[model samples]
Target: MIHANRWYAAATAAEISTQPTEHVICGRPLVLYRAASSGKLVALENRCPHRQAPLSMGTVVGDDIMCIYHGWVMNGAGQCVHVPHQDSVAPSVRVDAYPAVQKWGLVWLWIGDADKVDETLIPDMPWTEDANQSSVFIRFHVGANYQLMADNLLDVSHSDFLHASTFGSHAGRKAETEHVKAELDAWSEDGAVYGLRTLRDVVLSPMAAAWAGTDKPVTRTHKTCWTPPNNINIELIMENDENKVTIHHDHLMTPENETSCHYFLIWTRDFSVHSGYPTDEDVRREQSTVIGTEDISMVEAQQRNKIQFGDPADIPGAADKIVVAVHKRIAELQNEDQGLSAT
Candidate 1:
């Protein structure tokens, strides 16, 4: 229910350090650093109140950030600790602070109204709850609304076209989606918080069965959910006639602006191509046109139309059933924002 209470990715695991790092979240200029004494990462608004200088430009000396402008010092909580050229303690001036936690190999911060930041909304991954998964990490950035990119991912149909040159399987596409099963999943509020693994089935159309020569369906079962304005988590198993199972996940994180997103992922058991991890780089290397031109062309076009036009086709259809369900949930969350008066 908070405006910006959700946690977001601050930096890659390799970049976080005792040295203070400045970043903007939800459009709030913030700085992150490790405590000198405890080595715990902390987040604070980066601007100095006196002259509006960035405190992150200062030094991280002994558990405090010393502003380079005037040697004004602040502690981990953004509480002012010292003001040079004066003996009297400054009347407890402090910069805004955000709750920060480094988990899953990324620094997470809560940036909405702090009072409304529910820890539960911070996001929990039970599968990543294990330590070994720590070794797996993947990162990528796409220029698009975190939501649009997520919707594109929620449906695998794109793989047949967007990825056709590399991942195309005419047998797979012509394969009867109807034979696979049509599942209409939705939340009256939001959409795609999958509970029953909707996209996990192995039924091939007669074409695929004939091509792959499998009498039965070759199903890869999956469960996934998207957290807007930018984030996604998916877990799935890939299966062939051999009946062996491999597990994988796609993890996404969004910055405050919703213009671009970061992806952190793991391929514990699944191959990179199937996971969309390597294909991302492959498309970049082999077909720079698709990743660079096509993706940008589409997102920019979509943004233009989105600005000029109203919501496109609010109703739900076969391909858009998932999108409609998701729009519903987002509408629920933004409902309060809708009712507020300009006054």
Candidate 2:
């Protein structure tokens, strides 16, 4: 749903430790740095119009970000207030300043029409503040439609067959998907499409039972949800008789181009220190390497087919309900956007 705002993930908390870092998201250049004295954060255009030298090339002053070329310094507002080579009284030269909000340990940038972005509409994610739960992030670039990646992330049933040995259920129980609900945001940007798809299934695994110290064919029901413009959550209940849920998240496509998508995803699992995995990062890497490869294959194949087959213009089947919903939402949002653009 970020399509509606100027919203872009500028940088991570770790990357901005003290020095300024240049980041590019959705093709928009950004510079992020923390204030030396007060630890305040700032995000602005990476390019300094004066010489087009990247502001990120500059180091952080007390609270200002100073350019390395000729020592032109700008404050949090991105206004050039001091030119070391020039008189200290030089008139302020302001660069394009992006409205940045620091939340969820990531700096969010508003890159669209500055006057229209509404920060209030930012999506709410509950896990963003779950400090007790540690996490690891895995990022990737997909050579397909952003929507295609979102659709794949939202589909969990494919795991059974596609990821037979890699973090997927081999039990092959009598599983089924039931549509829970779908929603579209009314207040996001021009052509922002947002929705959710839920698939419910029961896990009946003999292997899991043996590993979990439980009876054979231990069965448990779980809920999986797919939310877009950018989110997919799969909640799996392990045999804790305790409904242990692991959430896998997806950030919908930030289009790298007309035909490619730059995507980010992370799967969250309760840290199991004694599961033979010393750190959550290892578990994350294992899962991502396996399942992520599987998805990349399918997504890339789909793209290839489209190029050779010429869109086919029609897809038929029940396996495509979520895809249908995605297309519908995209059309709706696009139509609304066209009108706004004309106005």
Model 2 over residues 225-303: C-alpha lDDT tens digits?
4433444444454544543444435353555444566665544545453363436766566656764678887988988
User: Which predicted model would earn the best lDDT?
Assistant: 2
Off by over 4 Å in 1: 115-117, 129-135, 167-192, 195-217, 227-230, 261-301, 304-316, 336-343
Expressed as tens digits, the lDDT of each residue in 48-74 for candidate 1 is 766778988888888888888988888
Clashing pairs in 1: 4-112, 26-256, 189-328, 189-329, 190-329, 200-221, 202-219
Evaluate model 1: give its TM-score. Answer: 0.73
- Each prediction's whole-model lDDT (CA): 0.57, 0.58
lDDT of 2 at 147: 62
RMSD of every prediction? 5.9, 5.9
Per-residue lDDT, model 2, residue 282, is 64
In Å, residue 254's CA in model 2 sits off its true spot by: 3.2
